[model samples]
Target: MRIEMTTLAEQPVAGVHICFFTDSLEPSGLGVHLLNLMRWLNPARYEMSLVCPDTPGGRWLMERAACVGAVVHPLTVRDRRDQASIDRLYHILTSERVTIFHSQVGISWEGMLGLRIAHRAGVPVRVVTEHLPYLLTHPGQVAEHRETTRLAHRIITVSEGARRTFLERGYPAAQFICIHNGVELPPERPLGEAARVRQELGVRPGAPLLLTVARMTWQKGHSTLLAAAHKVVARYPQACLAWVGDGPERPQLEAGARALGLAGHIRFLGQRDDVPALLGAADLFVLPSRFEGHPLAVLEALASGLPVVGTRVCGLEEAVADGETGLLVAPDRPDELAAAILELAGNSELRRRMGQAGREQVAARFTARAMARATMQLYESLLCEALGRTDGE
Candidate 1:
């Protein structure tokens, strides 16, 4: 499946063929980012393709990619060591005549094998976007991630903080770039949609509805948020915390909530497609993540004109301007989180002001079009360099 490298002049004149690879099997922030690229990348200048898992969860992304005219290649691999999968990927890359192979990584080393296969297939330009900061725990993964860094022609980090983390880890500064994650500013929710959502959740009107949209994972700090919810509810009995999204930690979190006697105050809505309406109904948005790579939830919340209460960690810190767009408290501190949430809950005017500021900030700096344009520019620069051609050419 080795593809012999060809000069740009040797190929028939056509748009650049860019193929994206991801191992994600579920709808996630990564999927949203990919959709943004698909929607915004000019079809006149580039042809797009996606290689993703073929599972039911993956179909959510597959269907969306197709709607945007990107060719979808359903892929399955039992494990990283599955040579058959690797060969299959190589064949796809070679047969598709991919000009640019861009892989998205949730953590460091994710989709590394795809990059390796793309490299072996002699793809002219290879890119990998790290959606999170580097992990410092595992020595084996650290080594593998370094190999991934070498395989990529360029490595994209979703936040400046994430890029700095890689630079501090000795990755070549010249090879990495920081591109902040962005979201499409959703259109206004249908009239009465917010009320309908609140009614469905059994939240009474005038009750403070604190909303959190994130997977029920340890890294998301759901436990810390649950603790904060306990404190917030004790003070304002009418306040309700609606938890959206689900993951492996859900059962444990539900059990903890029951144990804390928070059954009446906390509602687990699980995964729903009506997040925009939920955001519209919520009084404030809270994300108590221990770490992140520019969470889309916070951005969406801000876009929905809701002030955020997040942790003062790397990715969250960058998205939320403390005391302006939202309040950022120290991570893992339930008391601080509770205090901040209560502070916003008590002041409607302050919440409105901050929410307006957040919306303005997003419109000015973090739009899906901005992210896509930056990414496409990077792709073009790298492709031109690989072909020994200038941008003007």
Candidate 2:
């Protein structure tokens, strides 16, 4: 089906309506993805309607979102039907005349159903953003992914490393694109006064400070990072580690730290919104996650000009240039991780150089504007292709 063009008071637009069908817009990576995209998109050219399950955060955010002139539709989703999300999504597509459908995390069974619905409604195109390597998530979803990709006009991956995983899983390269996760850069961060944050964190001057910003989960590799810190402190006794997030795995990880006699060396700061300031005080940043697609924390670290040390996993490899921008070691290797951290912590030159290099990488390729521009261009291309129009003539 061809998308209808809309006429405004002064100009005409392609009349593209985007429908982001997700389970909910709670405090998660996918929610962040939705909000960030809405923030960066060109409002004059595109219209958006977010279809999600009812979530918290009051009318403050929703009211503010409406003030900006986008539509938010709440859904009462039930996961028991034959692709109920997909079925409901079809109704929304026809109702809103959506030109694009974007879904996050894994392919929702209902999400695939929705895509099929939109396609059948003559919406012309569908899009899916894979935030993680999902080839191993569920066998049925994997099959659905194949079918959806075959039907979709385009597919987006958060990282190049993740794109490779999809290709390995037999996803067609012809329809795939890499639009790395983009975040709004704070206008100005006075990284000067670290005294207050440091005092609050209870670290004396010249004490080696290491920081991590992630949820407490098995994939985050907090357990292994803690083990690495144990050996790190054994070599450099004054070193300390601070974590800035909480999750289901926190209690168990805390117990493991106690068992390893690292209770004092590690500080669980829970969740904090002072990440920008926290990155300023830290000497080194570390994220030894076992798996990832594109970690926003790593991006924040690099943007803050902190030297990051993470594992050689999906998405990370795309942002961190091995031994150039940041150090990448094999996951679950506390010994190698410890050595890499020691190398950065002990040498101020390597830390400064890598930190500078990391910042340059972020500026060059990972800006929010860049990500949004590429996404809009892709959406337009898909729309145009479905409309039987070639680029510009």
Candidate 3:
């Protein structure tokens, strides 16, 4: 017997061409989210292309996107306001016959510029995703937000908290959509060598292990985590804290850990591809972000069957489901953070229950398929409205 498979290119699509632009493809949450979106989106319903900066990270993104059947392009967009860059982007938009231009607004200055170029190119629909909410206190950021909002046909926020912030600041209510970030559920059985991985990380076989996977940036609250680690070790001498991911604050954070005599108990593991195994070998997951825009790490931790202890910030607030799946503490409060970690650490039963609850929550609400479906629905709505306007014309 012979079987035939339909490739994405051979399928009839909705004829809506969308080009997604990003700053770089560094191994960040945004990159991971984008990759998942490309993979899950119904290729039979729309055409997709990804444009990123011409850099190593951009090349990495291109390769990943290509693997998922997305057409990828790398462009040299050095400055947002540079006429040359704008001209190049405009040319690409026109040449590709792009119907919609989608991007994340705040991360790359060129994103806003791309929106303007798309508008000028007469693209019927333009969508921008806001992954982080900017404070209204900053006049410059507020101005930039307004400009980006005016240029886009719609704005997508990763959480309701982010949407509320923008609405309160006078952005049009109808223009915003809150779509929570999602993750693929972990395997039914743990995939990695849990015990061996823990031993390699210098964690004892039977000691409690706490894991945090976040860039060492000020916004991520590493300083507060370090302080909390000090209190954790004092209470449980055998406990070990592993810090994954790297950033500018690594030196300072490492120094703080040493200053507090936590060098032995704290391990800076840097970035690793084996995140699932890391979570499996751990007793709990902690995220001390001062703020967030629907962190994928929390969802991954939940899916990994690990109880999360994160700051009571926007996205985390929704992800944690406080007291159900995990605990939430005030941002920047190391003492409170320490107390929460200890609360989970001391009780194995509580940890196990919370972990089970978290896994259930992720499976129920936050899956990569859900995120892609919501996005595609939004795209269809805009495309229909565009068609309606053209018919009236």
Candidate 4:
């Protein structure tokens, strides 16, 4: 379904009109989380709308949201001080009679302006979901984060670690809720699909295949992975690393791989749609991220029944049980990262056991349906409280 514009008079409000706001312009994990919520939230009870930048990246997300029956509003704000954009957003909220204004924050203060505008618009419920663990050291950002905590009726963190980070920062513990991010578990791949993916990537049969699906950014620790890959290739000459996703650091990462004589061993596949097939063909999954907020990549890997090897940081640590579903190493430690990869690559049985455990963990706790149900409960509770206040008044 394409995003079609209609007049406010033509489209009468039904159910709860929830407006989701984000400043992010790219199709990142935050976008994925929004899509999952929109796709799973019951259309009969919740009406979803999105407010994002009007750039190409934002349009990419808007199209998908429209496909899932979410109304799309494209607005671009240069920063928190963009008064014109803020005014436009306020108008949208008031005109749409938005019942809930929910903002998704990827970084500090990314969506705080929307929260403030929502409050000014007199929305019944104002919610903000912090998709990353708080590590704000800058004084200005810290102050803004505090303001966000004060403005939002409820703050959702993607992982417990993220909520704890806010708590440690002295935000009210009761205002925060940890809702671990979830994934749509794909059905088993058809026979021969994995082999087809392997052949396309030129990964020879019997060669150790390690897969990593993350944007090529410093936060994702692609350089550290390359360092570890240098060591990994020494042990297994034919080992292949299929790096998925693309970002600003891609050129530097490609140069680093070539400089380290790993050009042949690592394939920099930029943003592929066929990730499930790649995960199936690979023997091990790795994400040496410096930090995360319940990363979708690791969950997708686990759901695909591939063991993971990730850094021992907040979000990653929470998703992976060390020595169980996958191995965890200290961030930026190339030697330790390489050792973990070697350990998994050398033991086929261990990988199998860990992969099975990971799949079970995702099925039991990390499905998108579970996430949507919990979030819907929170929305309904807030709505009930709002109704009570209105009645009492």
Clashing pairs in 3: none
Instruction: Compose the digit string of candidate 3's lDDT tens values, residues 240-268.
Output: 99999898899998888888999999899
Model 1 poorest ten-residue lDDT run: 1-10
Score each candidate by Cα lDDT.
Answer: 0.87, 0.75, 0.81, 0.87
Stretches of model 3 off by over 4 angstroms after superposition: 1-14, 24-27, 76-81, 106-110, 136-138, 189-192, 389-393
**Once model 3 is optimally superposed onto the true structure by TM-score, how far is the C-alpha of residue 208 displaced, in angstroms?**
1.1
Q: Give the clashing residue pairs of candidate 1, or none.
A: none
Error of 3 at 192 (Å): 7.4
State the lDDT at 122 in candidate 4. 74
TM-scores of the candidates are 0.96, 0.87, 0.91, 0.94
Q: Candidate 4: global Cα-lDDT?
A: 0.87
lDDT for each residue of candidate 4 in 100-156, tens digit (9 for 90 to 100): 888988886588777877777778888899999887888997887787568788999
Q: Give one digit per residue, the lDDT tens place, for model 2 in 1-393.
A: 223323111222367777776553343565666667778888877888776666653233354456656687666343536455545655677767666777654423435655555556666667887777754577876776577667677778898888888788777898888899877665456645677887788787788889998889888999888888878888777777999888889999899889988888789998676888888889989999998888888887888888999999988888788888779999999999999999888888888998888888888888777888898988888766666677775
lDDT of 1 by residue, 1-393 (tens): 333544432454357899899986664888988898789998899998999999876788899999999999899642667777877887788778888999988877578778877877878889999899987678887887787669789999999999999999899999999999888888888999888988888888888999999988888998998888877888888888999989999999889899999988889899898888899999999999999999999999999999999998988988999999999999899999999999999999999999999999999888889999999999988877787788577
Candidate structures ordered by lDDT, highest first: 1, 4, 3, 2
Better of 1 and 4 by TM-score: 1
The CA lDDT at 185 in model 2 is 60
